[model samples]
Target: MNTFQLSCFLAVAEYLNFAQAAKQLHVTHPAVSQQIQSLEKELNVKLFQRTTRSVKLTDEGKVFLWDAKQIVAISDRAKKRFGGVAGGNIETLSIGCYNFPCMFLLADTLETLRTIRPELHPRLQEIPFQHIYRMLEEGDLDAVVGFKESANVKINALYKEVAKVPMVCICSGSHSLAGQKELRLCDIKEERFVLFVPPKGMLSIAQTQGQLMGERPPSEFYFCESAEAITVLVKAGYGISVLPDFLVPDTPLISRIPLKDVDQVSFGIYYKSLQGNPALKAFIQCAKENLTALDI
Candidate 1:
């Protein structure tokens, strides 16, 4: 099969839905289906089991997924290497960061990069949690700083867990639950909940929360675009929310309480190990140093 067919397969496999995969690849559903059909024909094996309601990988498809990822990773790395040589050497290292990390760690990382690697120009982009891996695989980003759990998609990348931050439940100071020392998932089940909704086809904050609460869905949900907005809404008495400890603002109008059972959020930097850019290497080193100094 060709790279195009392999890419289509990878996207479909990751998302397990042709429509979502097509949207991520910026192609139509029929085109994605055609590529998958062509690849299955070439390989003489059925990769996916499809039904009207759901799509799943066959035993053979699960085995091929790893090899397909390797092929795409190698191809992308080669293109980057040759493209750099043809374009007269790469000068700038492009880094991506999600909103939370962008607010908390980006400035320090940039400062460290400037002090240690003054010769290399760095370009930082504010990316959504869902787009980070795709941009890195497409060679548009050299490195990224984001929540570790958000990088669950299987891809060719290296992740260094620099910090672990606990998540806290937040509510207005006047809310009934604010004065409670300990908060449980069931306690907030009936409260109006403000949740962060990522871009289309990405894992959402609400889904994560559901998993945290043992698959017990929130009673009433309010979807928003960012954690900052959630904070604003919480303070305005709109709804309560759970946010990373670092993102919780020091506001008198809100109270941050501990949750009963939830995992700490792992925050860190991710980059493709196959990338041999000197600037990228230096940036990663500086990032680790800064993170350690900040004790995050």
Candidate 2:
């Protein structure tokens, strides 16, 4: 009912752990619990099902989560609007990216946007991939910048592609496949696979790797939450992974081989609409003009 209660609810919903949510909100665990309890009492509905080991959202909580995000975003925007008016008219936009690498792709675009709209402040947040689009739809994020397949377009969302980067096979420098100039599916089918955790609402990179592997799948599979973890595993010769070239860091310890059959991923900005937002409109244009020029 109140912004405070909604904040507590959302933090709890995101983390699914009261202690972790309290840590994130910089509040004590009991305080968060009290807020959730009060909100549930006021609504006459249980928002969460809590036990000793885990906390899961109730049916009502799942339904309210989207609305809560929108409510908080509107509240934040209103505060920022008035606060900006009192402090020299500074506008802020929350931009979300999946990971650090995806965020790095915005460097040139953000710089270019600064020149055109100096008063527009872009707040870049590296959000989890699964939550990024959900946050965008709930208005917590004004826009998102990341890679998507060329064919992946949503009816309600708009994507402005800046550039296309090919997927590559990532392996340890000392691996047998490292000496290959280019790799095909069969070339590495027998090797162990390290893949990203399955994401929601977008194309699954792991699933794509599975399709590429076809009938002859790798004997072992390892899943990781981040590209960094995947890289670490590959460096230790645990397994190889397929990722966008930019996500692979430049290091002699790892080798990246161009994928012969995979389609290039389009790197771009995904926004709901540019009809009313001047900052987002300017950012999309800047990204289109500048991101294409990046060496990556």
Candidate 3:
């Protein structure tokens, strides 16, 4: 009928003595007897055969004992599992990021969280740039890392700039510009270009580069959705593109030239302003610490 009644039934069944069961449960003998009677009444079955000399289980009591034990065990486990929520002992921090930052920053942040709050579970979800703000506001994500300026200031979230990732020019190994150590916008203005379109309303690497170049657009614009795709096109000698330094994979077939005039993209962490989750705070702290080491 209830955990307390079931517990009393189990104690009596285990010892087969009302006085001993009461002693084991730290309750009075009459209290134990009352609970057993209540349970029998609730189930409409007698659980024990009692005599002046001794107490013994009914045939029904033996079968019901197993179910009672199982119910008690399950109740105990449920309490242990959910009891920590009020105490801040159990937490799962869901972090969102675009592909490149997910690859570069998520690992170090997870390691730090493991060391500091081993009880906290951390999840990393690769999200498109446009959906990040919506996810954070909707309680789907606890925190996110991406281009700092890309996050909408209109959203109710806190933003902390963690790193500045410089944009670099990538060209095929065979391209003439590949020989250059550094380049400016003027040098690549005439070269066919691959442009990355930011998801949603966020600014892409190409758009940022164009802002730095003033009224000049690329000689030819080839649009792609992701950094990886742009890299593939660049490697095939289709066009040159600008990308964050960390997004450039280590490959000899592609050459990365530093851009002198373009400002570095600011990467930051964003979390819902009102949800002061401890795990999110720890993750933000860990991210700031690992930014320099991650070289972003």
Candidate 4:
């Protein structure tokens, strides 16, 4: 019945968890639950089947999901159009990327963007890495924030390097390989490895193996969903992992040693083209100027 209700419905539909939806929307869990309840009541239909352990969409919910997305998209587009006219020519740049700690780095850049180009408003979405680049190509997203080595990037898209993030080997501070100035790929091969879920993660590992000339792969491997998750496992002594240096926490509990032979990933923005897009150009400049302050 309302944009707020529709937004809640879309978030819950995407994540299937009220808590996660609330987190994404920056609202309380009960607030999201209330919105869904109000929405379902207004529609005279049950949208989701709830359980203590899991949340699943009902049959009606499944049918309404696509419609809800379209409704929200249209509403957003209209707001941008009319809002721009009312504000005497404003621009909206829709950006998609994986979730934060990366966004943490972008916060300063976005603030700088505001100062430099107040007319340009950025709309950010935490899309899955698998679909992000494709959305950019499809024009659903104006830009993508990710690594250059990401398997999802295409040749046609232009890239602006924000930071060169080195690949580092991470382990518990008490681990045998800790206290080293740096490490070779072979040094960690015998240890159990923790990686992000593939195929992007696998491509990174393969690239590292090839470039670092690591002959033997780790005997055991663990796959995690996020770098934070991987770091948690590594700190618990579950396994060692290779990750962008910026992703590794500064805590003393973990040792982050640079990989001796691996190349740093070019982390930055990707867009189709900058032609006639002053907003995109200004954003790139702000990102380059501010993101370099990252202690790579």
Candidate 5:
């Protein structure tokens, strides 16, 4: 019903743990719980599933986070319609991004902006790919950079082709699969794979490879939502994973080989369909300057 109530609800829904949510909100655990209870009462539905050791969002809570954020964003933007700027200043650009290595684009953009206007400070949040769009629409972010997908979601790039990082199948350097210079999907048909999948969604990239193989090769698959987890699995020799080649060069223990027939992964800058924001426009321009180096 109110901003306070919605804020508490989303915080809890994000951390999925009362103490953690309270820490993030800088409030007491009881305070967080009280607000969530108030929201549940207002909505007449349970928003979460709770137990002694764990907390999880109910089906309703998952959907509510998006709509509630958008409402809050619109309200906040309405209050500061003129951006609190007198004439023109770089001000701020809030950005969210997937945990992909696509930050090179953002870095170039911000660096260029710094040279022209050093006062610019772009707030940044590292988020999952799926959350980027919702966060932008909610006013939490001005733009996002990650893999692009369509689902009534509009996306665009400052450059023609997608900005991409060369990703390769990484295994322990001395592992059996490391001997090959490059490999096809069939190379690891029977080996274990450390795959990254969304906590509540599909592994779109891995699925794309599966479809391209014509037949989904039987792989001993292990899935985790965290990219770090997947990397750890690869390090422990549990399985090889597809990761940005940038991350492997410094590691002496990991070896990355190309997926024989698969192409480089596509990544780009995405944002909601909205009029241009100056900070974002500047960043896009900087990103375009480095476009050729991105291997797009």
Candidate 6:
């Protein structure tokens, strides 16, 4: 009936132990019991089955549990939206990012939200490129920065473009192959390779270069989900990899060499249609100013 009752109900239903739930909620055990009893009376249902030893939710309680959580979520979103109504505009922005590019902007972007966009808080999540599209469709994320061009992904092609940096073939600086003036696909056909698995098998700039020289995909691979993970393995002298120039950070063991024959992926912002929120115009303008996007 009220927020207090709903909060108490959730705590009790989740833990099924009045004492434990009370401790978690920082309320007295009797207060928890009374709240649940009051909620049961308000709803006109036996929400819980209680014994001296244990507690269990009734079927009705289980069904109502889901609705209770949504009620809280909607309440929170409403609070955020309501805050914007007071001053200028307050909206929550959730941005999904692929692992490779997130390292650069994640901290800085959030810091700006803390200072500049004091009203509109932004939440950042690391996600695979495929998950971004699905989340956008479900209205989970407000935007993403990814290389993929899919049907559902709407691109905001701002003035900045992701520069075409040659995909560099990375090897341990001490590895015998590292000394070569240039590398062709034939250089490492017999050697083990480390690769970051591409979403939808989108060939990276290096993979495209490998194809240009008629090289077969490596026989063995150490597949990595994150660029950071791939670089760690490469630093440990695992095997050669074709990685974006950005990922080759300041690591001592790894070295990058241009592949000479591949196109660079465009780096840009992707957001769902702004039909739901009319205030995206100002936010997009702020984004354009903040992002100093360039080739890696």
CA-RMSD of model 2: 16.3
- Give me the runs in candidate 3 sitting further than 4 Å from their true place: 1-89, 100-103, 150-153, 198-201, 204-206, 209-219
In model 4, how large is the Cα lDDT of residue 203? 50
Residue range 91-177, candidate 1, lDDT tens digits: 688888777534456678778777766666777788866677799888898887776644456756788867666667899999888
TM-score: the better of candidates 3 and 6: 3
Candidate 2 ranges beyond 4 A from true positions: 1-87, 149-155, 200-204, 212-219
Residue-level lDDT tens digits of model 2 in 95-170: 9987888787778788888888988888999897657788888889888888763355442467787887878999
lDDT of 6 by residue, 183-257 (tens): 766566676777756443344543453453354554566777666777788778887777666656667677777
Model 3 pairs in collision: none
Worst window of 10 by summed lDDT in candidate 5: 152-161
Q: After superposition, how far is residue 23 of candidate 1 from its true place, in Å?
A: 62
Top-TM-score structure, candidate number: 3
Could you estimate the TM-score for every candidate? 0.58, 0.65, 0.66, 0.65, 0.58, 0.56
Ordered from best to worst lDDT, the candidate numbers read 2, 4, 3, 1, 5, 6
Indicate whether candidate 2 or candidate 6 has the larger TM-score. Answer: 2
Predicted structure with the largest lDDT when compared to the true one:
2
lDDT, each prediction: 0.77, 0.83, 0.79, 0.82, 0.69, 0.66
Clashing pairs in 2: none
What lDDT score goes with residue 284 in model 6? 50
What value does the lDDT take at residue 150 in candidate 5?
40
Off by over 4 Å in 1: 1-91, 100-104, 150-152, 179-182, 198-208, 211-219, 292-296
Q: On residues 191-243, what C-alpha lDDT tens digit does candidate 3 reach at each position?
A: 77777653432455647656544565544667787777888999988889888
